[model samples]
Target chain A: MKKSINKIVMIGAGNLGTNLATAIHKSGYQIVQVFSRTSESARKLAKKTNALYTSSLDEIYPYADLYILALPDDAVLGFLKSKKLNNFFMVHTSGSLPVSVFKPFSNKFGVFYPLQTFSKNKILNFTDIPVCIEGNDKRTESDLMKIAKNISRNVMVLSSEKRKQAHLAAVFACNFTNHMYTIADEILSRKNISFDLIRPLIQETSEKVKLMKPALAQTGPALRKDKQILSAHMKMLAKDENYKKIYSFVSKSILSKTK
Target chain B: MKKSINKIVMIGAGNLGTNLATAIHKSGYQIVQVFSRTSESARKLAKKTNALYTSSLDEIYPYADLYILALPDDAVLGFLKSKKLNNFFMVHTSGSLPVSVFKPFSNKFGVFYPLQTFSKNKILNFTDIPVCIEGNDKRTESDLMKIAKNISRNVMVLSSEKRKQAHLAAVFACNFTNHMYTIADEILSRKNISFDLIRPLIQETSEKVKLMKPALAQTGPALRKDKQILSAHMKMLAKDENYKKIYSFVSKSILSKTK
Candidate 1:
């Protein structure tokens, strides 16, 4: 058994940082400090969590047991390179970055990736969100796990490589999935159709996956190889070169799956 | 006031047909007949619905008030062309095919498109699914509405042209969205990672659309114009031309939305 993480210093008060800080605070842990190059973001999250805010990396409270770097991927690399890690355990909240990036920078390191899309304005209960965690040492892993378990119900240990692959997979599951919705919104808005018409369909598509694989749930002209309807759809998209390319590429990909 | 439909005949006992048969039956309407090109499917749905089954167009009960052509678009056209009207109202359960397709055959015609993804193995309540209806006459529209209302709480009138556009949008929203899941599945499976890890993310992405525009919910390397990460992701897809093309096309589309 490991001791619980009592004080957390949050770094990079972006969407993930702000959300995580608030969730951790609500879960009865203290967020001792919040840091961001953007002063407004840092101060905003700090006020919410009742933590000290700083725009300087050097100002992070040294007494905090955990530091969550929740900046963008490039910014994460920059923050790691620019700052010297105190003796605290460090982790990132990115989906894509490897834990190795924190290797040479911290005496205690791990990853604390929350596998969900976070928007700054939206408040979510961390209870059901999966938190994928990894650490270089057993105590570090358990301490991180303890922190994760305090805020989330679904925390699991994952290796750096597995987490990277999971992150790549997430690019499709969340990022590309939202991109598809964006395209649908564009198509309907052009026709003056309220996107409200498609909301139930969107929800049902995701819900079905909880019961079955997506490949089995797929139903459309592309999967059916209905050349007539596919051609009609392609012609509809012909006005936009980029959308046409996407339609063709994804249609062909769906067709290839059957083979 | 429009009289309620007394007896109904179902065509195409595939995914949509099977699901609708159950819903209509559960809604206290009589399914007089079930038709399918495959005898096994026709009998399977008929046994479940306690209706007569037929693989032949000639065997359809001519007295049923509503004839739901839930078959494929081409199969629908083929069924219409091969058989003469029995003086009953004809409607299709397709999003793409126009109501005009039924005009050439029936004295009364319309569409009864349920705007939800359906699977034969998965059962769903009709209460929330949007039912898009259009008919040649007021009575035809109202009769379809009665049947639709019996099975669903959401029933609205839409023209054939608008329904076609809505169907096109559905392909992107539901079809392409599921394909994104398939792509994610492939990516993780290659690394022997369980897709269970991403299920929460998938559910949350869809849930976000309920609260905000999907375009606003978008996040990833492509949207941020993070060149290094985007390049890294693109290289990962280099092994498959189709996927690489899709990744580039969608990424550029996302970038365009910011402008």
Candidate 2:
């Protein structure tokens, strides 16, 4: 097995795959091939990296030093079971899946999970995005770490269990947090208020967490336990049962955490 | 009433009050006095703004152009009721309360709500903070807008009802969003992972909404309707009922908003 990973095959041209391939390629690594279920996705990503594109698994470049499976968790296992191209060092970029998933498929494998939300077309600096790495062996681990270090300054070796926990935490912090913003947008739209008005508040709230513990940084009517304001907000949300439920549930949750 | 508000009295020395007083003072307004329930609180904020400190409502400067009741919503009314210093134009910084809350106390009154979370020690730039202004009359609105514009580049005249809705939206956007971070912290701590791992994701989530509608920026297993990953995350949260409830509730909320 090669200890130094130079040439790469990205097996999924999705959001993570596209961003990872582009970033890795930009860092002077050779992107040998790009593969996706759709030729359009493969072509689009391949064009950015100046690499070949393919929609079929059989068409993937087998000579690359590494194959990055940036597919969904299920697809990762499915792809491995479908093919026996285990000559290269393999890694699946999944938060929940373990490095052991590649045990039956490849003798040399690891997990290279970049822990960040990636949306296609959004320009991102991969320098600070946390890349969680785990390998079945020391050489495989070192190879994975080499690629990860080249792309990110924030990299850690996390076990599958720990990585999964971080993933669960991210779902709350990123996904659910965005949902809160969406609800706020919905609420503001009802009153014809522009979402721009609350952008600073949202920005400050996120910025505060970076500086202090989130619990210590929390501020609002709920944390204040202002019954008057809480009830007033609940009444305002009364028209929408879902929002009302959310407001009450989250408020209660906050109150419960109060010391 | 004066069309220009230069001399001001700040009532309350809490997070919002201290920050607002300092910002307003720094903007060249003369903060004549600072009041708080605790003398030490009043004195500390007073020292920053070069204003007199008072714990008693009776000691408040009666001749200032504006009496900013940066107190709690109830305290605003309480202070007004407890004193008849209605000669000056009055304004309260609150999201939920309407300008009419001051109708019984003074004719020259308005709402000067700076829509951002403020920490007492954290230095913040008020230049971009949205200042929602509402006044009882044209002259009062003009006066409040004058002061607001002095401190913030972003200022708007929003009606009481609309301001209340905006406040409601802010509770969701800021308060609830922070709670999500707290929950994420809890989840991460269980596996001994640093909170730093998810900061980039959280920061990006907030950054995305500034450029795009949050609903469009949403990415996760819930939004993607990946039942397998969703079930796995739910299982991970199974031990903590509150966290589990929050996880399932928010994931469902995200799914409901899905295209």
Candidate 3:
């Protein structure tokens, strides 16, 4: 039988690090050490997780069962290459990076990518966050899965390639979707209209997709192919060439989705 | 004080018509008649509101305090010109069309646009839906505002020009936003990943905007300006030229928002 993941050391006290470490700590696992480039972030997360704090990776507790590298994507590879691998398991919480990044350091490594956006100030409930996990070996996968299950109910043993695709999908759904709202906010603010006026509509649009496929939930001049209204809307954006291009291109794309 | 709106004639039994009529009827107003080009649609909505149903405009009950034209934007002007108007107030539920569309038909006309997407089968709560009301005259404005307030808690006496801009903003926030989800769904389905995996992320993105400006809430490769990941994502969409263009263009737009 594989040993259960008990003691953890969280590296990089950024947005994801703070939330993930706190979650693991709350799930009855002991977070042994919290590391960050800045002592303030390290101390802040360490206090929250009831763990020891360090500003340097050299000072990370060597005896922890798992070390979670929650640093930025670029920092992850260099950090993994430089660190000496012990018998303990290690994982990085990134969607785009593959599990093989850990191959140079150790075979007892995996990935624990929670597919959600994190902000330092925002409190998160990890109970339902979809944590995409992958391991280099069966034993590592099982251990990581157990630890992931303890924190999130929605844990999937996704492949590295699939994790990359999920990350891309999220860029469109979360990032591009938020950009659409930013454009709307910009348009309204131009006329001195409050963003609150569209908040209910925004809430309903997101809520509608939860109940049905977004393709089916779509409604607007674009979907209707109402040229008059579409041209009028385009004309309104004539002064802003970038917005007009977006309006035209996205509208055509949406039209193509019509059955 | 203006006369309180009580009796209503709902023309068009489409999505917006059904939802608006139901909400107004539920607010204790009498829906005198429901009109639609399709007899079945008229019958369906009429039965729901306990009102008379008619497929012909000539058979419409004309004595109601208000006539709500919830028809498509293009159909509104033609229908207004074809029908004879009495002294009773009339309003069309459109975002893009101006209140001046009524001046060619009747001086007693205005606009009562509820800024939310509607589906025929979906039940809606009008309490918080933003109902933008515009009137040709002071008396008409008061009557429409009273009628609007009864159905929705969020009512505004907006001008026609601002209403058009609000509608434009909604095209971005609601319609284009749904398209972004559609793109994400397409990408995930290509890899056989269930859209369910991203639902939590989609929900959190929307919820974040409610708390903060979408610009501030933005995350992902575009916001991070991670060149490696951005190019990686763009390469993934190489097969679909349309999607690839959107990925590149939208990423540039997102990068522009960084301040």
Per-residue C-alpha lDDT of model 1 across residues B143-201, encoded as one tens digit per residue: 88888998899999999888888988899899988998998998889988787879989
Candidate 1, residue B2: how far the Cα is off, in Å: 9.6
User: A70 in model 3: Cα distance from truth in Å?
Assistant: 1.2
Native-referenced Cα lDDT, model 1: 0.87
Candidate 2 per-residue lDDT, tens place, A1-259, comes to 4246788999998888988999999989999899999999999999999999999877778788888999998888889888657655789999889889888887889899998998888857899999999999887787788888998999889998898889988988998899999999998888778899899999999999987989998889989888999999888877877777788889989999998
Off by over 4 Å in 3: A1-3, A84-88, B1-3, B86-88
Candidate rank order under TM-score: 2, 3, 1
**TM values, all candidates:** 0.96, 0.96, 0.96
Error of 3 at A206 (Å): 1.3
lDDT by residue for model 1 over A80-178, one digit each (tens)? Answer: 777656455889887677878887777788889988888898978999998999887898888889888988999999887777778777888899889
The 10-residue segment with the lowest total lDDT in model 3 chain B: B80-89
Q: Cα deviation in Å at residue B111, candidate 2?
A: 0.6
lDDT of 3 by residue, A120-183 (tens): 8896999999999999888889889999999999999999999999999999898889999999
Off by over 4 Å in 2: A1-3, A84-88, B1-4
* Cα lDDT computed for each candidate against the true fold: 0.87, 0.88, 0.89
Q: Between 1 and 2, whose DockQ is larger?
A: 2
